[model samples]
Target chain A: MIEFSNWDILRNLLLAAQWTLLLSIAAFIGGTVVALTLTAMRLTRNVVVMRIVRVYVELFQGTPLLMQMFLCFFGLSMIGYEISAWGAAILSLTLFTSAFLVEIWRGCIDTLPKGQWEASRVLGLNFLQTLRHVILPQATKVAFAPTVGFSVQVVKGTALASVIGFVELTKAGTMLNNATFEPFKVFAFVALIYFALCYPLSLCSKYLEKKYHVAR
Target chain B: MSLVKLDQVHKYYGDFHVLKGIDLNIKVGEVVSIIGKSGSGKSTLLRCINGLEAYQQGGIAVDDKEVTSEDIQVRRLALSVGMIFQSFNLFPHLTVGENIMLAPTIVLKKSKQEAEKTARAMLEKVGLGDKFDRYPEKLSGGQQQRVAIARALAMNPKVLLCDEITSALDPELVGDVLKVLEQLAAEGMTLILVTHEMNFARDVGDRVVFMHQGKVWEEGNSKKLLSEPQTEELKQFIGAVL
Candidate 1:
C-alpha cells in the first residue's frame, strides 16, 4: 500500500476543490441565462409556450438531481451521443439549477402588484420596456434573498456530479479514502471544504434579507 | 365628431358577462362622470376606452384610432389616451419626476432633458412642483394620487380616463384630487371620470352617466340627472351611495 501523508491528502483534495468551484461558477451562470430566457418566454402570455415551460419546471424539479446526472452521462452515451463527464455534469447541473431558478424568479415577478404591469402598459410602454423600467427593478429587490439562498443549493448540488466520475470535492474524498484507508479524515475535509464554499452564500442571503428588509 | 366613442362594447370574464353592449360618446373638452353600483360596468367602460381592459365584441375609438388587443395597436392608441386607477398606480421604485418622465422618455422617445421638463411641468399642474424628487412611497396617499395624475398628463393624451381616481384616498384627501380634476376640466383637457362623488359630478361634470347592469341607464346634464332620478335603478343607485 502507498503511504500517503496528511499533506498529500490535503493537496489532492484542494486540487479537486478547484474543479468544484469551477463547476459551480459555470452552472450558476448557465442557470441564470437559461432561467432568464425561460422567464421572458413565459411573459409572452402564450398558452402553448407557457405550458411547455410549466412542464419543464415540473420535470426537472420533480425528479432527483442525481437521476438527471445519470441520464445526461450514461443515458446519452448509451444512445450513441459522445458526452464527456465534465460536459454531462455541467449540463445536468445547469438544467437542475435553472428549473428551480426560473420558478423562483416567476414567484418574485408574481409578488408585484398587477397594476404595475397595467400602469406601464397603459402608458404605452411595450412589454420589454415595462420589464426593463418598472417590473424588473421592483422584482429584483424581492428576488435577492431567495436567489442567493438558492445558490447554496447549486453549490451543494455539484456534489452529485461527482457520482458521474466528475472529480470534484466529493469524488476526490472518496478516491483518497480508497488510497489511504482513512475515511474519517478525508470525508471530514470534504465536508469542511463544502462548508467553506457554501457558508458565505448562506451569510450573504441573511445579510440581504436584513439589508433590503423587503418592504413588499 | 366625438373625441371618444364606444359603440356596443361587450366584455366577459369567462362565462360571466361584465359589460353588456355599452354605447357612449363624448366630445372634445368634455368631462363625463360615470357613477354606478359596485358591479356595474362604469369602471369597465372607462377601461375599455383606453384599451386597458379588452372587450370581446364591439368597437372603441379614441381620436379615430380603433382600440384592439394587438400590442402595437394598443400602444398606438395609448398615445392618444391616458388613464389613472382607483389605487393610484404610481411606480414606487422611481422618484416622482422619474415616474412622470418614464413614458415620455422611452415610449414617446423624448430626450432626457425634454422628458424632465415635461415631468416638471406636469407635476406643477398637479400642485406638486416641489415634489419632483420625492419617491411615491414617501408621499401621502393623496400626494401619490396627484403624482399618478401628473404621470398620465405627461403623455399629453388627447383624452384622460379616471377610474375612480379618488376611491383610495382619505376622505380629506379626496377633495385635493377632485380639485385637480376640476382644474383639468376648467382647462378643457377632455376628462372622463368614474366616480362616487355625487357633489363633484354635479358641480364640475359637464355630463353624468348612470350605469346599471352594464348599460347606461340614464345620462343628462350632471345637475339635472342627479337631481331628478328618471329610472328606479338610478334612483336606487343614488339612494344607496348618497
Candidate 2:
C-alpha cells in the first residue's frame, strides 16, 4: 500500500472542489431558467399544455437521479454519439434541479391568497401580466428562503455526478482512497470540504427565513 | 344610457343559486346600496357586475358592452367599473403610491409621471399624501382601505362597487372610511355597495335594495325602504338591524 500524505490528499480535494462549485453554479443557473419556463407552462389554462407539464414533472420526480445521470451519459454514447461526461452530468443535474424547483415554486404561487388574483384580474391584467406585476412580486418573497435552502441540496447533489466519470471532490476522494488504502481519512476529508462549502449557505438561508418569514 | 344593466341574471355555485333571474338598471351617477344578511348574495351581485364571478346564465352590460363573451371583456368593463373588497387586498409588495399608480400606468397605459401625479393627488384627497412611500402592511386597516379606494378611483371608472368595505374595520375606523366613501358619492361617482351599516344605507344611499333568497326582495328610495319595507324578510332584516 502506498503511504498516504495528508497534505497531498488535502491539495487534491481542494482542487477537485473547484469543479464541484462550478458544476453546482452551472446547474443552478440553467435550472432557474428552465424552472421559470415550467412554472409558466403549468400556470397556463390550456389542458394539453398543463397535462404535458404534469407528465414532465412526474417523470423527472419519480425516477432515481443516479440512473438519470447514467442514462444521460453512457446511454447517449451507445447510439454512436459521443458526449463528454461533464456535458451529460450538467444536463442531468439541470433537468433534475429544475423539476424540483418548479414544484417548489408552484407551491409558492399556490400559497398566494385568492384575493390577490381577483384584485389583479379586476385591474384588467391578463394572466401573464398579472404574474409579472402582482403575483410574482409577492411570490418571490415566499420563494426566497426555500430556494436558498434548496441550493444546499443541489450542492450535496453534485456528489452523484462522480458516478458518471466526472472529477468532482467525491470522485477525487474515491481515487485517493483506492491508492492510499485509507477510506476513513479520505471520506472524512471529503465530508469536511462539503461542510465548508454548504454551512455558510445554510446560515444565510436561516437568516433570510427569520427576516422575511418566507414560509408564512 | 344607464351605466349598468343586468337582465335575467342567473348565477350559481354548483347548483346553490346565488343570483336568480335578477333585473336591475343603474343610470350614471347613481348611488345604489344593496343591504342583505350574510350569504344573501349581496356580495355576489356586486361581483357579477365586474365579471369577478362567472354566472351560469345571465347578461350583464357595463356601459352598454355585453359582459357574457367567451374572450371576456374585462379590460373594457373594468375601465368603466372599479371594485373595492371587504378586505382591502392592496398589493403588499408595492408602496401606497405604487399600488394606486399600477392600474393607471399598466391598464390605462398612462405615462409614469402622469400616473404618479394622479396617484399623489388622489392620495392627498384621501388624506394620505404623506403616506405615499409606505407599504400597505405599514398602514392601518382603514388607511389601507382608503388606499384601495384611491387605487380604484385613479382608473376614473364610471361605476364603483364597494362590497362590505367597512366590515373589517374597527368601529372607530369605520367612520373615516365611510367619510371618504361619502365624499366619493357626493362627487357623483356611480356607487354600488353591499353594506351592513344600516344607518349609512339609510343616510348615504340614494336607493336601497334588499336582496333576499337570491333576488331583490324590496327596492326603492332609501327613505321608503327604511320606513316602509314591503316584504316580511325585509321587515325582519330591518328589525334586526334597528
Candidate 3:
C-alpha cells in the first residue's frame, strides 16, 4: 500500500489545474474562430457550403462530449494515429465548444429584425459591408451576454477531459482518493476548486445577462 | 431623362401579389409622394426601387441603370437610391454620427475623417448637431427618425425613397420631421415619400400617386388629387381621411 502526503496531493492538483486552464483557453479560442466560420457558412446562400456546415454542426452537437473524447483519444489511437492526451482532449473540446457556440451566436444573429438587413441594403452596403457596418455591430451587442454565459460551461466541460487520462484536476482528485481512501475530502476539495473557478464566471454571466437583457 | 422608371414591376410572396404590373416614372429632382392604405404596395414599391425586394418581372432603372443585375450597377443603384423606413431603424450600436458616417466610410470609400465631417454636417441639417455622440436609444423617437433621415442624406443619394417616415411619429413630432423633409425637397433632393399626412403630402409633393390593391390607383398634381380626387377609390380614400 502506498501513501501520498497532502502536500504531494495538493501540488499534483495545482499542476493539473494549469492543463485545465490551458485546455479551456485552447478550446474557447479555437471554438470562437470555427464558430464564426460556421455562422458565416450557415448564413450563406450557397447550398453546398450551408449543407457542409450544417452537417459539421450536427455531428459535433449530436454526440456527447464524452463520446467525442473517446473517439479522439482512443479511436484515433486504435487506427495507429497516436496523439497526446492533451491533443485529444483539446480536439474534442474544440469541436464541442464550436458546435454549441455556432448555435448560440446564430440565435443572436437570427434575433435581429429583417428590417435591419433591408435598411442596410438600402444604404448601399454589399453583404460584407452590411455585416461589418450594420448587422454584426448590433448582433454582437445582442450576442455578448449569452457568449459570456457560455464560458462557464466551457470551464466545467474541461473536467470531462480527465476521463481520457488527461492530468487535470479531476484525474488528480481520483488519484488522491484512491491512495488515501478519503473520497469525501479529496472530492470535496476538487469540487470547491471547480466552484471557485466557475462560480465567479457564472455570477459575471448573470450580471451581464441582467445588464444587457439579451433575451428581452 | 427619367431618374427612375419601373416597367411592369411585379412582386409576389408565394403567390400573394404585393405589387402587380406597376409602372411609374419621375424626372430628376421631382418629388413624388405615394399614398396608400396599409398593405397597398406603397412600401413595396419603394423597396423594389432599391432592389431590397426583388421583383419577379420588371425593368427598374435608377439613374438610367437597371437594378436587376449582378454587376456593380446594382450596388451603384443602391448608392443612388436611399430608402428611409416607418421605424427609424437607426443602428442602435452606433452613435448618431456613426450611423450617418458608416455608409460613406464603407460604401463610398470616404476616409473616416471626411465621412465624419459629412455626417456631422447632415446631423446639423437635421437639427441634431449636439447629438453626434448620442446612441439611438438615447434619442427621442422623432430625433431617431431625423437621424435616420440624416443617415440617408449622408449617402448624397440621387433620389431619397421614404416609406412612411412620419407614420410612427406622434402628431407634434410629425411636423418637425416633415419640416426637415420639406427643407430637403426645397433644396431639390429628389424626394419620394410614402406618407399618411395628407397636408404634408399636398404641401410638399410635386406629384401624388394614389396606390390601391398593389397598383397605382391615381396619379396627378397634389392639389388636383387632394381637392378633387377623380377616381372613386381616391375620392373614398380622401373622404375617409377627411
Candidate 4:
C-alpha cells in the first residue's frame, strides 16, 4: 500500500475542489440563462409554448439528476455521440438547475399584485416593457433570497458528477480513500470542504431574507 | 367638444353584467363625480373609459379616438386618459419620482431630465414635492395616493379617471387627497371620479351621477342631486351613506 500523508491528501483534495467550484459556477450561469428564457416562454399567453415549457420543466424536475447524468453520458454514447464527461456533467446539471430556478422565479412573478400589470398596461407599456420596467424589478427582490439559497443546492449537486467519471471533490475523496485506506478521514475532509463552500452562501441567503422580510 | 364619450357601453364578467347600457359624455374641463353603494358598477364604468376593462358592447371614444383592444390603439388612448385607483398602485420598489417618470421616459420617449422635470412638477402640484426621492412605502396612504395622481398626470392626459381614490385612505388622510383633486379641478383638468365622500362630491363636482345595479340611475347638478333625490334608490343610497 502507498503511504499517504495527511497534507498530501488535503493538498490533492483542495486541487480537485477547484473543478467542483468551476462546475458549480458553470451550472449556475448556464442555468440562469435557460431559466430566464423558460420563464419568458411560460409567461407568454401562447398555450402551446407554455405547455412545451411545462413539459420540459416536468421532465427535468420529476426525474433524478443522477438519471439525467446517466442519460447524458451513456445514453448519448448509445446514439453514437460520445460526449466528454465534463460536457455531460454541465449539460445535465444546467438542465436540472434551470428546471428549479424557472419554477422559483415564476413563483416570484406570480406574487406581484394583479394591479401592477393593469397599472403598467394603462401607462402604455407593452408586455415585455412592463415586465422589464415594473414586474421584474419587484420580482427580483422576492426572488433574491430563495435564488441564493438554491445555489447551495447546486454546489452540493456537483458531488453527484463523480458517478459519471468527472473528478470533482467527491471523486477525489474516493480516490484518496482507495489509496490511503482511510475512508473516514478522507470523507471528513471532503465534508469540511463542502461546508466551507456552502456555509457562507447559506448565511447570505439568511441575510437577504431578513433584509427583504419587511417588504413582503 | 366632448373629451370622453361612452355610447351604450355594456360589460359582463362571464354572464354577470357589470356595466349595462351606459351612455355618458364629458366636455373639456368638466368635473363629474359618481357615487353609489358597493357593487354599483361605478368603478367598472370608470375602468372601461381607460380600456383597463373592455366593454363587450358599444363604443368608447376618448379625445375622438375609439378605444379598441388593439395594443397600439389602447396605448394611444392611454396617453390621453390617465387613471388612479383606490389602492394607490404606485410601484413600491421605485421612488416617487421614478414612479411618476416611468411612463413618460419609456412610452413617451422623453429624456431623463425632461421626465424628471415633469415628475417634480407633478409632485409639487400634489403637495408632495419633498417626497420625490422617497419610496412609496415610506409615504402615508394619502401621500402615496397623491404620488399615484402625479404618476398619472405625467402622461398629460386630457381626462383623468379616479376610482374611489380616497376610499382606501385613513379618515384624516382622505382630506389631503381630495384637496389635491380639488386643486386639479380648479386648474380645469377634466376629472371623473367614483367617490364615497358625498361632501366632496357635492362641493367639487359639477355633476354627481348616481349609479345603481350596473346602470346610471340618476344624475344632475351635484348639489341638486344630493339635496333632492328623484329616485327611491338614490334616496336610500343618500340616506345610508350620509
Candidate 5:
C-alpha cells in the first residue's frame, strides 16, 4: 500500500482542477453559442421550429445531468460513435448549461415593455434591427447577473463528469481517497476548492442583480 | 386625394371585436382627432393606418400603398406613415439625437450626416433643439414625448398617427406636448390623433371623429363635432374626459 502525504493529495487535486476549469470554460462558451442560436430560432415565431427548440430544452432540463453524461459517454460508444470521456462530459455539460441559459435569457428579454417592439415596428425597423439596436442593449443588462449566476452551476456541474470516468476535481479527490484512505480530508479539500471557484460568482451575481435592479 | 384611408376595416382579437367596420379618411395635410371611451377602439383604428394591428376585413392605404399586417407591406407603409404612442416609447438606450436618427439612418438608408441633419431639423421643429444629446430618461415626460415626435418625423412619413400622446403626462407637462402637436397641425402635416385633450381637438384638428363600441359614432368639423356631439356615447365620453 502506498501511503500519501497531505501535500501529495493537494498537489494532485490542484493539477486535476486545471482540467475542471478548462472544461467549465469550454462548456460556458459552447453553451452560449448554442443558447444564442436556439434563442434566435425561438424568437423567429415559427411554430414548428419553436416546438422543436422547446422539446430540446425540455429533454435536457427534465433529465438528470448524470444520465446525460452517461448517455454521451457510454450510449454513443454502444452505437459505434466512439467518444472520449472528455468529449462526452463537455458535450453534456454544454447542452445542460445552454438549456437553462436560454430560458434565463428569455425571461430577461420578455421583461422589456411591449411598446418597445410596437414602437420599433412603427418606425420601419425590421426584426433584426430592432433586436440589435433597441432590445438587446437593454436585455443584455438584465441578463448579466443571471448569466454570471448560472456559470456557478456550470462550474459545479463539472463534478458530475467524474461519474463518466472523466477525471476532474471530484475524480481527483476520489483517486486521492483511494490512494491515501483519507476520504474525509480529500473530499473536504475538493468541496473547499469548489467553494473557492463558486462563491465569487455568487457574490458577483448578487451584486449585479442589485445594480441592475437599482438602475431600473 | 385622401392621403390615408381605412375602408370598413374590421378587427378582432379572437372573438372580441376591436374595430368593427371603421370607415374613415384623411385628405392631404389634414389633422384628424379621434376621441372615444375606453375599449372604443380609437387607438386600434389609428393603429390600423400604420398596420400595427391587422384587420380581418377591409383595407387600409397610406399614400396609395396597400396596408396589411404582413411584414414587407408594413415596412413599405412605415416609410410614409409614422405612429407615436402615449408612452413616448423613446428608445431609452439612445440619446435624443440618436433616437431621431435611427429610422432615417436604418430604414431610409441615409448617411449619418444626412440623418443627423434631418434629426436636428425635426428636433428644432419640436422645440427640442437644445436636447439633441439628452437621454430619454433624463428628460421630462413632455420633453421625451417631443423626442418621440421627432423620431416619427425623421421617417418623413406622409401621415403621422398620435395615439393618446398626452394621456401619460403630468397635468403640468401635458400642455407642452399638445403645443408641439398644434405646431405640427398648423404646418399642414397630416396628423391622426387619438386624444383626451378636447381643446386641442377643437382648436387644431381639421376634423374630429368620435368612436363608440368599435364604430365611428360621429365625425364632422372638429369644432362642430366636439361642441355638438350628435350621439349619446360621444356626449358621455366628453362628460367623462372633460
Candidate 6:
C-alpha cells in the first residue's frame, strides 16, 4: 500500500472540491432559470401548463438524486446521444435543484395576501407587470431564507456526482482511500470539507430568516 | 349622461348570487354612499363598477365606456376609475411616494420626475405630505388608508370607488380617513363609498343607497333615507349598526 501524507490527502481533496463547487454553482444557476420558467407557468392559471410543471417537479423530487445521476450518465448513451459524466451530473443536478426551487418559490408566492394581486390588477398592471413590480418584490423577501437554506442541500448533493465518475470531492476521497487503505481518515476529511463549504451558507440562511421574518 | 351607470348587473360566485339585477346611476362629482349589513352585496356592486369583479349579466359603464373583461379595456377603465379597499392594499415593499407613483409611471407612461411630482402633490392633498418616504407597514392604519387614497388619486381618475375604506381604522384614526373622504367630496371628485359610518354618510353623501339581499332596498337623500327607512331591512340595518 502507498503511504499517503496528511498534506497530500488534504491537497487532493481541496482540488476535487473545486469541481464540486463548480458543479454546485452551475446547477444552482441553471436550476434557477428553469425554476423561474416553471413557476411562471404554474402561475399562469392554465390547467395544462400547471399539470405539466407539477409532473416535472414530482418526477425529480420523487426519485433519489442517485438514480437521476445514473439515468443521466448511462441512460442517455443508450438512446444515441453520448454525454460526458460532467454533462450528465450537471443536467441531473440542475433538474433536481429546479424541482425543489420551483416548489419553494411557489410557496413564497402563495404566502402573499390575495389583496396584493387584486390591488395591482386594479391599478392597471397586467399579469407580468404585477408580478415584476408588485408581487415578486414582496415574494422575494419571503423567499430569500428558504432559497439560501436550499443551497446547502445543493452543495451536499454534489457528492452524488462521484458515482458517475465526475471526480468531485467524494470520488477523490474514495480513490485516495483505495490507494492508501485509510477509509476512516479519508472520509473524515471529506466530511470536514463538506461541512466547511456548507456551514457558512447555513448561517447565512438563518440570518436572513431572522432578518426578513419580521416582514412576513 | 351619468358619469357612472350600472344596468341590471348580476354577479355570482358558483351558485351563490352576490349582485342580482342592480340598476344605479351617479352623476359627475356626486358622492354616493352605499350602506348595508355584512353579505348585503354593497361592496360587490361597488367592485362591479370598476370591473374588479365580473358581473355575469347586464352591464356597467364608466365615462361612456363599457366595463368588460377584455384586458386592454379593463386597463383603460382603470385610468378613469380608481378603487380603494378597507385593507388599504398599499404595496408594502414600496415607499409611500413610490406606491403613489407606480400606476402613473407604468400605466400612464409618465416620466419619473412627473410622477413623483404628482405623487407628492396627492400626498399633500391627503395630509400625508411628510410620509412620502415611509413604508406602508410603518404608518398608522389611517395614514396608510390616506396613502391608498393618494395612490389612487395620482392616476387622475374621473371617479373613485371606496369599499369600506375606513372599516379597518382604529376609532380615533377613523376620523382622519373620513376627513380625507369628506375633503374629496368637497372638491367634487366623483366618489362612491360602501361604509358603516352613518353620520358621515348623512353629512358627506349626496345620495345614500341601502343594499339588502343583493338588491337596492332603498335609496334617496342621505338624511331622508337614514331618518326614515322605507323597508324593514333598512330599518333593522340602521338599528343594528347605529
Clash number for candidate 3: 0
Say which prediction, candidate 3 or candidate 5, comes out ahead on TM-score: 5
Q: What is the C-alpha lDDT of each candidate?
A: 0.91, 0.89, 0.86, 0.93, 0.91, 0.92
* Fold similarity of candidate 6's chain A to the true chain A, as a TM-score: 0.97
For candidate 5, write residues A43-140 as lDDT tens digits. Answer: 99999999989999999999999999999999999999999999999999999999999999999999999999999998898999999999999999
For all candidates, the clash counts are 0, 0, 0, 0, 0, 0
The alpha-carbon lDDT assigned to residue A58 of candidate 5 equals: 99
lDDT of 3 by residue, A1-216 (tens): 777776777777778787878889999998999899899888776899988888998999898899999999999999999988999998999899999999998898889888787777777778888787778877887777788788878888999998989988899899888888988878877887788888887788778777777433
State the lDDT of candidate 6 residue by residue for A143-172, as single tens digits: 999999999999999999999899999999
Q: Name the weakest run of 10 consecutive residues (lDDT summed) in model 5 chain B.
A: B43-52
Superposed by TM-score, candidate 1 places the C-alpha of residue A21 at a distance from the truth, in angstroms, of: 1.2
Write down the worst ten-residue block by lDDT for model 1 chain B: B44-53
lDDT per residue as tens, model 2, A182-215: 8999999999999999998899888987977843
Residue range B1-242, candidate 3, lDDT tens digits = 89999898999989899999899999888889899888999988887887777789878988877887452555778778888899888887888888898888888899999999998899999999999998888888899999999999898889998888887888889888998999998998898888888998898889999999999889989988899888899889988987
For model 4, the docking class works out as: medium
Candidates by DockQ, descending order: 5, 1, 6, 4, 2, 3
Per-residue alpha-carbon lDDT of model 4 for A77-152, expressed as tens digits?
Answer: 9999989999999999999999999999999999899999888888899998999999998999999999999999
Poorest stretch of ten by lDDT in candidate 5 chain A: A1-10
TM-score for all predictions? 0.95, 0.96, 0.93, 0.95, 0.97, 0.96
User: Which segments of model 2 are wrong by more than 4 Å?
Assistant: A214-216, B69-72
lDDT of 6 by residue, B1-242 (tens): 69998899999999999988999999999999998988999988887888777889998999999998766777888889899999999998899999999999999899999999999999999898899998888999999999999999998989999999888889999999999989989998999999999999999999999998999889999989999998988889899989
| Docking class for candidate 5 | high
DockQ computed for model 3 against the true two-chain complex using alpha carbons: 0.63
Two-chain DockQ for each candidate model: 0.81, 0.65, 0.63, 0.73, 0.83, 0.76
* Candidate 1: segments with Cα more than 4 A from true spot: A1-8, A214-216
TM-score for chain A, candidates 1 onward in order: 0.96, 0.95, 0.92, 0.97, 0.97, 0.97
DockQ, candidate 6, vs. native dimer: 0.76
Residue A84 of model 5: what lDDT?
Answer: 98
- By the lDDT metric, which is better: model 2 or model 4? 4
lDDT for each residue of candidate 4 in B41-69, tens digit (9 for 90 to 100): 98888888887777899999998889876
Docking class of 1: high
